[model samples]
Target: MKVKSLFVLTAMIGAIAFHQTALAKERETGRSTGPVVYVIAQDKFYDSIVLADLPAKGRFQQLFPGEGPSGLATEYGPGDVGYLGGRWWVDGNENGEMDEEDAYFLCPLLGPGRDDI
Candidate 1:
Protein backbone atom coordinates (compact mmCIF):
# COMPACT_ATOMS: atom_id res chain seq x y z
CA MET A 1 0.00 0.00 0.00
CA LYS A 2 2.80 2.43 0.81
CA VAL A 3 4.57 1.80 -2.48
CA LYS A 4 1.41 2.35 -4.51
CA SER A 5 0.67 5.61 -2.76
CA LEU A 6 4.22 6.82 -3.36
CA PHE A 7 3.98 5.99 -7.04
CA VAL A 8 0.68 7.84 -7.46
CA LEU A 9 2.05 10.93 -5.71
CA THR A 10 5.13 10.90 -7.94
CA ALA A 11 3.00 10.66 -11.05
CA MET A 12 0.81 13.57 -9.99
CA ILE A 13 3.81 15.77 -9.31
CA GLY A 14 5.32 14.87 -12.66
CA ALA A 15 2.15 15.79 -14.50
CA ILE A 16 1.94 19.20 -12.87
CA ALA A 17 5.60 19.92 -13.62
CA PHE A 18 5.08 18.99 -17.30
CA HIS A 19 2.08 21.30 -17.63
CA GLN A 20 3.97 24.28 -16.19
CA THR A 21 6.92 23.67 -18.49
CA ALA A 22 4.69 23.59 -21.58
CA LEU A 23 2.98 26.86 -20.64
CA ALA A 24 6.31 28.54 -20.05
CA LYS A 25 7.55 27.40 -23.45
CA GLU A 26 4.46 28.82 -25.19
CA ARG A 27 5.02 32.21 -23.55
CA GLU A 28 8.73 32.28 -24.33
CA THR A 29 8.16 31.41 -27.99
CA GLY A 30 6.02 34.53 -28.50
CA ARG A 31 2.84 32.60 -29.34
CA SER A 32 0.28 34.56 -27.35
CA THR A 33 -0.59 38.23 -27.94
CA GLY A 34 -2.95 39.56 -30.61
CA PRO A 35 -5.07 42.68 -31.33
CA VAL A 36 -8.67 42.98 -30.11
CA VAL A 37 -11.43 45.23 -31.47
CA TYR A 38 -15.22 45.39 -31.07
CA VAL A 39 -17.89 46.76 -33.45
CA ILE A 40 -21.62 47.22 -33.14
CA ALA A 41 -24.39 48.37 -35.50
CA GLN A 42 -28.04 49.04 -34.83
CA ASP A 43 -31.15 48.23 -36.89
CA LYS A 44 -31.41 51.88 -37.95
CA PHE A 45 -28.51 51.43 -40.44
CA TYR A 46 -26.07 53.06 -38.02
CA ASP A 47 -22.77 51.21 -37.44
CA SER A 48 -19.80 51.80 -35.12
CA ILE A 49 -16.26 50.40 -35.21
CA VAL A 50 -13.55 50.21 -32.56
CA LEU A 51 -9.92 49.12 -32.95
CA ALA A 52 -6.97 49.00 -30.56
CA ASP A 53 -4.82 46.70 -28.48
CA LEU A 54 -6.32 44.88 -25.55
CA PRO A 55 -6.98 47.25 -22.66
CA ALA A 56 -4.18 47.52 -20.15
CA LYS A 57 -3.57 49.28 -16.87
CA GLY A 58 -3.38 53.10 -17.12
CA ARG A 59 -4.93 53.06 -20.61
CA PHE A 60 -7.81 55.39 -21.47
CA GLN A 61 -10.85 54.51 -23.59
CA GLN A 62 -10.97 56.30 -26.94
CA LEU A 63 -13.85 56.94 -29.35
CA PHE A 64 -13.39 57.99 -32.99
CA PRO A 65 -16.42 58.57 -35.24
CA GLY A 66 -16.06 59.13 -38.95
CA GLU A 67 -17.16 62.29 -40.70
CA GLY A 68 -20.68 62.32 -42.13
CA PRO A 69 -21.18 61.15 -45.72
CA SER A 70 -20.10 63.60 -48.40
CA GLY A 71 -21.21 62.12 -51.73
CA LEU A 72 -24.27 60.34 -53.08
CA ALA A 73 -22.45 57.03 -53.20
CA THR A 74 -21.57 56.73 -49.51
CA GLU A 75 -24.36 56.88 -46.99
CA TYR A 76 -22.78 55.79 -43.68
CA GLY A 77 -19.81 57.76 -42.49
CA PRO A 78 -17.08 56.25 -40.29
CA GLY A 79 -18.02 56.45 -36.61
CA ASP A 80 -16.10 56.09 -33.37
CA VAL A 81 -12.96 53.97 -33.08
CA GLY A 82 -12.06 51.33 -35.69
CA TYR A 83 -13.03 47.67 -35.83
CA LEU A 84 -10.93 44.55 -36.36
CA GLY A 85 -13.50 42.63 -38.45
CA GLY A 86 -16.58 43.52 -40.49
CA ARG A 87 -19.67 41.88 -39.12
CA TRP A 88 -22.72 42.68 -41.24
CA TRP A 89 -25.48 42.20 -38.73
CA VAL A 90 -28.55 41.88 -40.91
CA ASP A 91 -32.10 40.81 -40.13
CA GLY A 92 -32.39 38.29 -42.96
CA ASN A 93 -31.05 34.90 -44.00
CA GLU A 94 -27.43 33.83 -43.60
CA ASN A 95 -26.01 34.66 -47.06
CA GLY A 96 -23.09 36.71 -45.51
CA GLU A 97 -23.97 39.58 -47.84
CA MET A 98 -26.10 42.69 -47.67
CA ASP A 99 -29.68 42.83 -48.98
CA GLU A 100 -32.27 45.52 -49.63
CA GLU A 101 -34.22 46.82 -46.60
CA ASP A 102 -32.06 44.59 -44.39
CA ALA A 103 -30.77 46.50 -41.39
CA TYR A 104 -26.97 46.06 -41.25
CA PHE A 105 -24.30 46.75 -38.62
CA LEU A 106 -20.85 46.26 -40.14
CA CYS A 107 -17.69 46.58 -38.04
CA PRO A 108 -14.67 46.90 -40.30
CA LEU A 109 -11.99 44.62 -38.79
CA LEU A 110 -8.73 45.87 -40.25
CA GLY A 111 -9.00 49.60 -40.65
CA PRO A 112 -11.69 50.82 -43.09
CA GLY A 113 -13.11 48.27 -45.54
CA ARG A 114 -10.26 46.03 -46.60
CA ASP A 115 -10.20 42.60 -48.19
CA ASP A 116 -7.64 41.20 -45.72
CA ILE A 117 -7.25 41.82 -41.97
Candidate 2:
Protein backbone atom coordinates (compact mmCIF):
# COMPACT_ATOMS: atom_id res chain seq x y z
CA MET A 1 0.00 0.00 0.00
CA LYS A 2 2.79 2.42 0.89
CA VAL A 3 4.67 1.72 -2.37
CA LYS A 4 1.50 2.24 -4.41
CA SER A 5 0.83 5.58 -2.74
CA LEU A 6 4.43 6.69 -3.27
CA PHE A 7 4.28 5.79 -6.96
CA VAL A 8 1.03 7.73 -7.41
CA LEU A 9 2.49 10.81 -5.71
CA THR A 10 5.64 10.61 -7.80
CA ALA A 11 3.61 10.30 -11.00
CA MET A 12 1.51 13.35 -10.13
CA ILE A 13 4.61 15.43 -9.41
CA GLY A 14 6.21 14.38 -12.66
CA ALA A 15 3.09 15.21 -14.61
CA ILE A 16 2.92 18.69 -13.08
CA ALA A 17 6.59 19.34 -13.78
CA PHE A 18 6.16 18.29 -17.41
CA HIS A 19 3.13 20.51 -17.83
CA GLN A 20 4.96 23.52 -16.45
CA THR A 21 7.96 22.91 -18.70
CA ALA A 22 5.68 22.68 -21.76
CA LEU A 23 4.01 25.96 -20.87
CA ALA A 24 7.34 27.73 -20.39
CA LYS A 25 8.54 26.50 -23.76
CA GLU A 26 5.37 27.76 -25.37
CA ARG A 27 5.87 31.21 -23.86
CA GLU A 28 9.46 31.34 -24.99
CA THR A 29 8.37 30.34 -28.49
CA GLY A 30 5.85 33.22 -28.54
CA ARG A 31 3.03 31.14 -29.94
CA SER A 32 -0.47 32.62 -30.36
CA THR A 33 0.44 36.07 -29.06
CA GLY A 34 -2.39 38.10 -30.59
CA PRO A 35 -4.10 39.29 -33.75
CA VAL A 36 -3.31 42.26 -35.96
CA VAL A 37 -6.25 44.61 -36.52
CA TYR A 38 -6.48 46.16 -39.97
CA VAL A 39 -7.96 49.65 -40.09
CA ILE A 40 -9.41 50.28 -43.54
CA ALA A 41 -10.59 53.60 -44.84
CA GLN A 42 -13.75 53.91 -46.88
CA ASP A 43 -11.90 54.60 -50.15
CA LYS A 44 -8.46 53.15 -49.50
CA PHE A 45 -7.04 49.84 -50.65
CA TYR A 46 -3.70 48.74 -49.22
CA ASP A 47 -5.16 48.86 -45.69
CA SER A 48 -3.62 50.18 -42.46
CA ILE A 49 -2.51 47.22 -40.38
CA VAL A 50 -1.84 47.10 -36.63
CA LEU A 51 -0.43 44.35 -34.48
CA ALA A 52 -2.63 44.17 -31.42
CA ASP A 53 -1.35 42.79 -28.13
CA LEU A 54 -4.61 40.93 -27.75
CA PRO A 55 -8.13 40.92 -29.09
CA ALA A 56 -9.89 42.96 -26.45
CA LYS A 57 -13.23 44.65 -27.07
CA GLY A 58 -13.39 48.46 -27.09
CA ARG A 59 -9.72 48.47 -28.03
CA PHE A 60 -9.10 51.18 -30.56
CA GLN A 61 -6.48 52.58 -32.88
CA GLN A 62 -6.67 55.85 -34.74
CA LEU A 63 -7.33 55.74 -38.50
CA PHE A 64 -7.11 58.41 -41.17
CA PRO A 65 -9.55 58.43 -44.04
CA GLY A 66 -8.00 58.60 -47.47
CA GLU A 67 -7.70 62.02 -49.10
CA GLY A 68 -9.52 61.32 -52.33
CA PRO A 69 -7.35 58.89 -54.35
CA SER A 70 -3.61 58.52 -54.18
CA GLY A 71 -1.83 60.37 -56.99
CA LEU A 72 0.50 57.38 -57.29
CA ALA A 73 -1.36 54.44 -58.77
CA THR A 74 0.78 51.94 -56.86
CA GLU A 75 0.28 53.45 -53.43
CA TYR A 76 -2.73 52.05 -51.59
CA GLY A 77 -4.60 53.87 -48.85
CA PRO A 78 -6.29 52.51 -45.69
CA GLY A 79 -8.34 49.37 -44.92
CA ASP A 80 -10.37 47.72 -42.19
CA VAL A 81 -9.57 44.59 -40.19
CA GLY A 82 -10.67 41.03 -40.82
CA TYR A 83 -10.49 37.52 -39.32
CA LEU A 84 -10.73 34.01 -40.76
CA GLY A 85 -9.27 30.53 -40.19
CA GLY A 86 -8.60 31.43 -36.52
CA ARG A 87 -6.34 34.34 -37.47
CA TRP A 88 -6.64 38.01 -38.43
CA TRP A 89 -6.43 38.51 -42.18
CA VAL A 90 -6.75 41.38 -44.69
CA ASP A 91 -8.02 40.11 -48.01
CA GLY A 92 -10.12 43.31 -48.02
CA ASN A 93 -13.25 42.15 -49.81
CA GLU A 94 -12.22 38.50 -49.50
CA ASN A 95 -12.18 38.81 -53.26
CA GLY A 96 -8.50 37.81 -53.40
CA GLU A 97 -7.59 41.41 -54.20
CA MET A 98 -7.68 44.93 -52.79
CA ASP A 99 -10.30 47.24 -54.31
CA GLU A 100 -13.03 49.67 -53.37
CA GLU A 101 -15.48 46.80 -53.03
CA ASP A 102 -12.99 45.13 -50.70
CA ALA A 103 -14.19 46.37 -47.33
CA TYR A 104 -13.31 45.72 -43.72
CA PHE A 105 -14.05 42.51 -41.86
CA LEU A 106 -15.25 43.26 -38.34
CA CYS A 107 -13.32 41.14 -35.87
CA PRO A 108 -15.21 39.11 -33.24
CA LEU A 109 -14.53 35.42 -33.82
CA LEU A 110 -11.89 35.24 -31.10
CA GLY A 111 -11.12 38.81 -30.16
CA PRO A 112 -12.54 42.33 -30.23
CA GLY A 113 -15.50 43.95 -31.98
CA ARG A 114 -18.25 46.53 -31.39
CA ASP A 115 -19.93 45.15 -28.23
CA ASP A 116 -19.57 41.72 -29.89
CA ILE A 117 -17.14 40.38 -27.36
Candidate 3:
Protein backbone atom coordinates (compact mmCIF):
# COMPACT_ATOMS: atom_id res chain seq x y z
CA MET A 1 0.00 0.00 0.00
CA LYS A 2 2.80 2.44 0.93
CA VAL A 3 4.66 1.78 -2.35
CA LYS A 4 1.52 2.36 -4.44
CA SER A 5 0.82 5.66 -2.74
CA LEU A 6 4.43 6.77 -3.25
CA PHE A 7 4.32 5.93 -6.94
CA VAL A 8 1.09 7.86 -7.47
CA LEU A 9 2.48 10.92 -5.69
CA THR A 10 5.64 10.77 -7.78
CA ALA A 11 3.63 10.54 -10.97
CA MET A 12 1.52 13.54 -10.05
CA ILE A 13 4.63 15.60 -9.30
CA GLY A 14 6.20 14.64 -12.60
CA ALA A 15 3.07 15.57 -14.53
CA ILE A 16 2.90 18.99 -12.88
CA ALA A 17 6.54 19.65 -13.64
CA PHE A 18 6.08 18.72 -17.28
CA HIS A 19 3.10 21.04 -17.62
CA GLN A 20 5.04 23.93 -16.18
CA THR A 21 7.91 23.32 -18.54
CA ALA A 22 5.58 23.29 -21.53
CA LEU A 23 3.95 26.55 -20.48
CA ALA A 24 7.34 28.21 -20.10
CA LYS A 25 8.39 27.02 -23.55
CA GLU A 26 5.21 28.38 -25.09
CA ARG A 27 5.80 31.80 -23.56
CA GLU A 28 9.39 31.84 -24.73
CA THR A 29 8.27 31.03 -28.27
CA GLY A 30 5.67 33.84 -28.20
CA ARG A 31 2.86 31.33 -28.81
CA SER A 32 -0.45 32.60 -27.55
CA THR A 33 -2.55 30.16 -25.61
CA GLY A 34 -5.67 32.36 -25.59
CA PRO A 35 -7.79 34.17 -28.08
CA VAL A 36 -6.09 37.15 -29.75
CA VAL A 37 -8.27 40.13 -30.51
CA TYR A 38 -7.44 42.49 -33.42
CA VAL A 39 -8.87 45.70 -34.77
CA ILE A 40 -9.50 45.94 -38.49
CA ALA A 41 -9.00 49.49 -39.61
CA GLN A 42 -10.05 51.27 -42.75
CA ASP A 43 -6.70 52.92 -43.32
CA LYS A 44 -3.08 52.94 -42.24
CA PHE A 45 -3.71 55.94 -40.00
CA TYR A 46 -5.65 53.75 -37.59
CA ASP A 47 -8.28 56.34 -36.92
CA SER A 48 -9.78 56.23 -33.49
CA ILE A 49 -13.20 54.66 -33.34
CA VAL A 50 -15.39 53.04 -30.76
CA LEU A 51 -15.88 49.28 -30.90
CA ALA A 52 -19.63 49.69 -30.41
CA ASP A 53 -19.67 52.03 -33.39
CA LEU A 54 -18.56 49.30 -35.79
CA PRO A 55 -21.31 48.19 -38.12
CA ALA A 56 -22.06 44.62 -39.12
CA LYS A 57 -20.87 43.08 -42.38
CA GLY A 58 -22.56 44.34 -45.59
CA ARG A 59 -23.06 47.64 -43.77
CA PHE A 60 -19.79 49.40 -44.57
CA GLN A 61 -21.55 52.63 -45.51
CA GLN A 62 -22.87 52.95 -41.98
CA LEU A 63 -19.36 53.46 -40.65
CA PHE A 64 -18.32 55.90 -43.36
CA PRO A 65 -21.44 57.71 -44.32
CA GLY A 66 -21.41 59.84 -47.49
CA GLU A 67 -18.55 57.80 -48.93
CA GLY A 68 -18.89 55.84 -52.16
CA PRO A 69 -19.00 52.09 -52.22
CA SER A 70 -15.60 51.65 -50.61
CA GLY A 71 -16.38 48.14 -49.48
CA LEU A 72 -14.73 47.46 -46.07
CA ALA A 73 -11.42 47.83 -44.25
CA THR A 74 -8.85 45.07 -44.78
CA GLU A 75 -6.06 46.35 -42.55
CA TYR A 76 -5.46 44.73 -39.19
CA GLY A 77 -4.37 47.59 -36.93
CA PRO A 78 -2.78 47.20 -33.55
CA GLY A 79 -5.02 46.19 -30.73
CA ASP A 80 -4.42 46.65 -26.99
CA VAL A 81 -0.81 47.10 -25.91
CA GLY A 82 1.60 44.27 -24.95
CA TYR A 83 1.52 42.75 -28.45
CA LEU A 84 4.35 44.70 -30.03
CA GLY A 85 5.82 41.85 -32.06
CA GLY A 86 2.57 40.27 -33.19
CA ARG A 87 1.81 39.72 -36.88
CA TRP A 88 -0.83 41.78 -38.71
CA TRP A 89 -2.30 41.91 -42.20
CA VAL A 90 -2.37 44.91 -44.53
CA ASP A 91 -4.37 45.64 -47.64
CA GLY A 92 -1.67 45.80 -50.25
CA ASN A 93 -4.07 47.01 -52.92
CA GLU A 94 -5.33 49.85 -50.69
CA ASN A 95 -8.80 48.57 -51.42
CA GLY A 96 -11.28 47.48 -48.81
CA GLU A 97 -11.04 43.82 -49.68
CA MET A 98 -9.18 40.70 -48.57
CA ASP A 99 -7.84 38.91 -51.59
CA GLU A 100 -4.69 37.17 -52.77
CA GLU A 101 -2.98 40.57 -53.07
CA ASP A 102 -2.98 41.27 -49.34
CA ALA A 103 0.23 40.95 -47.30
CA TYR A 104 1.31 40.42 -43.73
CA PHE A 105 3.45 42.74 -41.61
CA LEU A 106 5.13 41.95 -38.33
CA CYS A 107 4.79 44.51 -35.57
CA PRO A 108 8.24 45.73 -34.65
CA LEU A 109 9.29 44.74 -31.15
CA LEU A 110 11.30 47.89 -30.65
CA GLY A 111 12.45 49.20 -27.33
CA PRO A 112 12.52 52.76 -26.10
CA GLY A 113 14.46 55.21 -28.35
CA ARG A 114 13.40 53.08 -31.30
CA ASP A 115 16.04 50.49 -30.54
CA ASP A 116 15.63 46.78 -31.15
CA ILE A 117 14.68 44.82 -28.07
* Cα displacement (Å) at residue 4, model 1: 0.1
Model 2 local distance difference test score: 0.26
Q: Which candidate is the best by TM-score?
A: 3
- Give the per-residue Cα lDDT of candidate 3 at 98: 42
Q: What's the CA RMSD for each of the models?
A: 20.6, 20.2, 19.9
What would the per-residue lDDT of candidate 1 be over residues 1-117, giving only the tens digit for each residue?
334333433443344344422111233324322221222231112222323222122312222222112100122224544322343322223354433322333334332332111
Cα distance off (Å), candidate 2, residue 112:
34
Task: Give residue 64's lDDT in candidate 3 (0 to 100).
Answer: 18
Q: How far is 52's C-alpha from truth in model 3 (Å)?
A: 34
Candidate 3 lowest-lDDT run of ten: 108-117
Per-model CA lDDT versus the true structure: 0.28, 0.26, 0.28
Give the per-residue lDDT of model 2 (tens digit) for 7-58.
4334433443444221112233243322222222323222112222222223
Q: Tell me the lDDT of model 2 at 110.
A: 24
In candidate 2, stretches whose alpha carbon ends up further than 4 angstroms from where it belongs are 21-117
Q: Residue 116 deviation, candidate 3, in Å? A: 15
Candidate 3 TM-score over all chains jointly: 0.24
